[model samples]
Target: MTLLDQPTGPSASVWPPDAHGPRRDPAPLLPDPEPFRMLGTPAADKLDPELLRDLYRRLVLGRRYNQQATTLTKQGRLAVYPASTGQEACQVAAAAVLRETDWLFPSYRDTLAVVSRGVRPVAALTLLRGNAHHGWDPKAHRTAPLCTPLATQAPHAVGLAHAARLRGDDVVALTMVGDGGTSEGDFHEALNFAGVLNAPVVFLVQNNGYAISVPLSKQSAAPTLAHKAVGYGISGRLVDGNDAAAVHSVLTEAVEHARSGRGPVLVEAVTYRLEAHTNADDATRYRTSDEVVAWRQRDPLAVLERHLREHDLIDDAGVAAAAEAAEELAAEMRAEFHSEPELDPMSLFEHVYAEPTPQLREQADLLAAELAAEADPR
Candidate 1:
């Protein structure tokens, strides 16, 4: 039989019966063999000097924000704070890449990203403040509330992107998740839907060494988190998470690709969390001080600052200006957290539904009556 007419497995089609089945070469979707770098490389010269300076300023501010937020938790201001201490590059670049019209769906540890997107510093921590409602208006800023559930925001982002496409709107929804979140079913579903629907969305996974106390080795065996995109027939990109310029470049490309109706892109940023997972986590138990110190040697802020100074993009005055700005923000956060918010217990029933259910209405009435009685005793 001719090569094309060969039969196998009792089938007359071809030697390989599945030869006609649809297949796609995954080479284009695979991540780079090495994490993309920019800071210490010649590529750094290609970035805009002004943009580099701005990124430096933001990184400084983000570091201060993480420090102050963690202090708030110690002072009993916030119920819990998930500090992105060492991952500022990922946070800042994730927001910097998007346009004002785009949406940012952030995880609990991504307060810096939300704040970078123009949300008030204190308001970004509202959910962690134990408030019943989100601190910032999602509709007003095109930012969703800080999601505490792992990977849940991924699906929400995909849904929003798909809906926008159906409405003939050109909007990109970028969502941030940690390495641990990639293991969730929601992550898988989101990638699947985004690929099938060709939705405009970008998934940024900050592979910051550990998912809580679990190291990356335990969370995923995939060569890299970005490689997971290939399974969904999407593009995958890997970057030095601590390199602000590289993260911004990669994410900007992914966002633009999605904006051009090319579907989704998954980017994995290799970073390290310098702090415990949260105020509640004890990282010492699972990790060694040497590991933390080694990562600190490659701190994102320092890395960017080095590049800027080397390129003469920033000077002593510029560094001082950035520090002053960060101090001002920290002061603002401290003042805001020290003051108590005026919360109405009854307002909890307001946003639960368009129309309150009978049970909810009854509870609201009961609470109102109790407050009235307490205000003026009979």
Candidate 2:
């Protein structure tokens, strides 16, 4: 039974709201009525010119990376790719706000963020390529595996943050999840635990409008994803996911809040997934062309570029330089992915356990024996 359903006694009268309900003070947790925008605003003038340039370059490369990765999928180099074509701002800013020493726990859609976090581009796609369990070493890069299971990474981020606090480590764990993931039990548990433990972690929800074939309208009826944070006693922030400057500014604040021992914070970046959920899904089946076109007008890269140009921070030469660099990166990825990778079937059993069980060892031996026989006979 829920707490609200419990029988109320004389002592219950002393409780706040007389046990009617949680009656949480939500004023402090309310997100802005509209998603915060900065690219075209006067506030954009105050931002550092170099930082704006950096964001623009990253956005350019990030867009190119998404295109190349999607192309790789079509070419059979990558098993599948969930492109962040229109959501480059969220990806880039998520990384830009983080320190190298900080940990990033990313969902499968966050490969761009992983790459921006200093992981080699090729290594970040290892899992997506189906060549390895994870693309990079978690301990080495301070990035967890790209989680395919929805909302599971939330709890992992909370656990790591809580542990770091216990050990007196000066670290913050920023976990990224999609809006749909907010409905999962793990998401609730993680938020609740983080709030109670005062863990230094930031939860970023990229509200990309749809969860696969499902639209946000079919999802939870929460006013905004950020509002969910208030229930957990954590701060909530909302920002225009298409505005890189706004995303970076908001995330920077949230990260600083967590790092300062103020407890966990939740940020919802309002973005739209312009592409299909993956190369395998047909977006045309669910969305209209006009809708896609509308979002394209506010494209993250274009918005930032326009802002920079208006401020005289970048000109045609700068744009060309950025594009050229992006092309080079894309070319490098294409060449690297075309090369065949060495594989060992036996290696799969190696990392599954520290000490393999007798049953596992027997299975491994059986596979090995079968391989050896086939090698000699065929």
User: In candidate 2, what are the lDDT values of residues 310-356, reduced to their tens digit?
Assistant: 88899999999999999999998988897979999887787778999
Q: Residues 147-248, candidate 1, lDDT per residue (tens digit)?
A: 899999999999998999899888999999999999899999999999989999999999998888888999888999999999999999999999999999
Q: Please give the CA lDDT of all the candidate structures.
A: 0.92, 0.91
Best by TM-score: 2
Score every model by TM-score: 0.91, 0.92
Per-structure clash totals for the candidates: 0, 0
